[model samples]
Target chain A: MSSTAGSTLTHQETDLHLQGVINRPYQVVVWNDPVNLMSYVAWVFRSYFGHSKEKARELMLQVHHRGKAVVSSGAREKMERHVTAMHNYGLQATLEEAE
Target chain B: MARAFRATTRGYKADLESHERRLLSQLCADVITMLETRGKQLTGDDAPAGTDAEDDYAHFRRELAGLGDQIDGSDAAGGLAPPDDAALARLLPDASSDPQEAAQFRRLSESSLRESKLADLRAARMALEGEPVSLTEEQAPVFGRALNDVRLTLASRLGVEDEADAEQIHQMAKAGSAATTEALMAELYAFSTWLQETLFSAMLDVMPEDD
Candidate 1:
């Protein structure tokens, strides 16, 4: 018998796996920075996310004390948009593969 | 013949204390309407020159739409929650604090409430005064000091800090890197619109309406 396990032949199967991998969820993370004020960070959250002042302040404090916070998480495209917004707002924001 | 005398009564109309409270409530509403737009401009992705009274307004609506998102995203955004009835009972103003100043702070805290009306109020007020104001939220203590300087200058010159002049509130944003010209302009426009509400609210508290 031919070594079927060693030889990959199903193109459709490979494509399916690739698609699934590409569709995996991504995370949007806002890192704590020295420059932006805690209040400003809260404002960004309030301004960008429509958060209440108390909620925004709590998140800001979380980021301030926690070193970083995952401000959002979702589809890669959505995470990318969030990251771009954070950048626009001058936050040290980033996106990465969610573990 | 004489008209029958009737006691006209609306519980609190003539009460100086209630009028002061009313003044604060009105001012709070006005400031929220005006400054909310400027606060929006601070982080808008659009180009600056594109904004005007109308466009800033439309964008303000869009930005405020994200208010829920902001609140959901950060606990801090909500700030102090409204006091529960029990908590509120214990929250009477201290005898030492000036009622007017307390009114101003209440207006400031409520500044995010009704945005569009506030924006209109701002535009009208600015046209009447022929100047502008800066409504940007303070950053660092130093920036607050700078804002005070700008605020003092504006009060002396035109009676309010004008965000239209970016040079004045230059370093108010302590964190963020240098923004592109377009980004900076957009921020400036937003902030100026924000100023309209803030100053108007403060003014309303102090500026009694003409009879």
Candidate 2:
């Protein structure tokens, strides 16, 4: 229950909301691979995710050095489609629950 | 589209040759190092980070994708370097669709055509050994086409069409011109590396969450 001092969430309402509400976030995770080039990875992010070249490259670098990066968070189905498309394009990619 | 034959030919064998493969792998390692360095540059620079490296990487990927698209387009256009459809037919397990069948036919035709080139090489070797064998008129064309195919395949893959240029580069490299070949090899290696990275990044952006 996200109730605070200034917020008027009545006790009855808070109890009712707490009964059964779960927020499940899906995360798009890119994995490091030996085959792909870093620049190419960045380009892909730009093209597919509509990320600006700079943002895409930054994400690519993070994935390159860090070995992985969560590029997006949203619905599970959307993430699945994205993963499949990446695989089709010859990239090693996957999805996971957002931490 | 109707199938048309060009005076040109190409093969994947050369593209995936042992030496080429080895060179490509080495190039990939170098690219990784470059990526790491670029990343460091981004992190170390306090001034508007992220843009420079990212832009460069995107351009690199676009170059690779452009190369791929060029080759595929050539195949469609039935240019002089149209792939050997006949060889593909022989290799394909099944040709379910018309397009698939067409590709196979092109591959097979090229292979059958290249057999004569192999024979010519053998003949040349025999001549060097002081053994002579006469060839029929038909046999002569086979050798010519086979060699032509090899040349075109290399040309198209490299996004070039000038046979003269290809031969010149080939000769220079064979003659131990290290600097020139090194530069060319570096480029090809970068291309392959970029291709791999582009696919990886694209997949990461689009893949769904696991259960």
Candidate 3:
């Protein structure tokens, strides 16, 4: 039951193309750092991102084996917020335009 | 001997000796001082500011006066640069690979990040005040973060740039000699690594697997 209340043009397609220059999704990438513990990283991914234990472990491993991993992706502002949150958790994270 | 953090009926507990507690609390206070100094630096004052025993009006006046000048600047784009000190830089890293963008992002977010980290460290000091370090479920994560910050500071001083560097530090700690300051840092780093490992492992044990 989508709300269709306030349109002079009724029954219009709400799904317009938003993936242009302005709406390109941004991602928060967490980098592997020697100071942060593996267990701590997994916990941060779980509690902060609400990832399942397995999923969080998987992402933590990716950051461990690979140089980094994109833990989240969304609007630029949201990704920026996530990057700040990751920084607050003492994890090295950078915000980038999602490919 | 410091007992590893373990899940208990109430929340989480670690049995630390008095000296250990004192050491951790002092470290927390040191980090708090570092962050407060950093905050003042970010607000564009090299001299430590705003800890007067005067009246509230004086404080408010200082606040507006300090902020007023900064806001009046024409371009907010040229923001505060990251700290030159390796420990401070590691604690608050760049949010972007691009230098300009990273500076801008640091300008926008570093203050609040510093505040939150300081808050965690203060809470950790309070937690350390007890006979046995006990944490409520809510407090555990905050304590964990403060412990991690201490480790990060030690790691920076130990020059732990990569896995190889970390291995050297581990070996140094395993040698069990604090003859030099570097060896002492390694010992503290290893101790923090063990404590944090136990903490998160206990925490993860309680969290739902949902596999």
Candidate 4:
């Protein structure tokens, strides 16, 4: 009986692990575009996402230099909403399945 | 006449002469018209049958049709596609790398997004149309967004890619050369940027110090 209970607990743990694997977090990536000003991008990061000015500048520089930067990561729905908001603010953005 | 925007106890206030107000109203009206035209074009109706615009829409539709395997069924809304124009593309960027996901994002949000911009433009126009061009607290953000959109459009058209480019344009404008289209656009871009900055500063004045 004890052996059966232990096996059941192990199965539940495996199920949870599989669920975690299947539901990996999604990331919102802001892509650098020539049209948007660097100052404007930093301001959007600071104001919209409420990041610190320094942090915003760091992220903006990442985007400018690397062509893109993952600004936030979370559940797929939240990431989608973030991408949409970024679009509304005239910034190029996308969602990616997190690595 | 030098007119600057300032934050008032009531909201944000800008003192402008009648002609200046009239010109601003006209500009807002023009932007609204442009946004509406773009919105129609997105739905694949405004473009003629065999034009590039229509072709682009067809491609988008085909991409969307093939997206069933990638995206969830509930995310597909089937609205307009992305714009081909650089200015419109800047204003409404794709929200996803995947064409299917981007199309779904556009379908679900583009109309409302366009409407919000239109609403902002309208609010600014209405405020200017009044005797006193003052924006309420709620209306201030709308005006600010409208100004930003106008500036974005102008900057895109002027090809102001970076600070250096914008600075050169500013110098050209300051030299008082309206002889070229680039010079004229630069002047307009500078004016719009100044106006937007003024409004933003006014809003900043009203914010808490900690912010």
lDDT by residue for model 4 over B1-211, one digit each (tens)? 6477788889877777787677667777877887887766555456566576755564565466654321112233553456657777777777766776677777778778888778888888888886567888778767767777777787778877776777887788888787888787677677766666677666655644335
When candidate 3 is compared with the true two-chain complex, its DockQ is 0.75
- In model 3, the clashing pairs are none
Off by over 4 Å in 2: A1-22, B1-211
- CAPRI level of candidate 3: medium
DockQ per candidate, 2 decimals: 0.01, 0.03, 0.75, 0.31
Residue B83, candidate 3: how far off, in angstroms? 0.7
Model 1: runs farther than 4 Å from truth? Answer: A1-20, A52-55, B1-211
lDDT of 4 by residue, A39-82 (tens): 56766787778887678889999999988998999888788788
lDDT of 2 by residue, A27-99 (tens): 7777764434455566568767788767777898888788887787777567756654454333445556667
Instruction: Give the range where candidate 3 chain B is weakest over 10 consecutive residues by summed lDDT.
Output: B67-76
Question: Residues A1-99, candidate 1, lDDT per residue (tens digit)?
Answer: 112255464645656665556567767677764334454566567656766666667788888888777777678667756765564344556566678
- Model 1 chain B scores worst on lDDT over the 10 consecutive residues at B87-96
DockQ rank order:
3, 4, 2, 1
Off by over 4 Å in 4: A1-16, A31-47, A52-69, B44-81, B209-211
Q: Which candidate should be chosen as best, given lDDT against the real structure?
A: 3
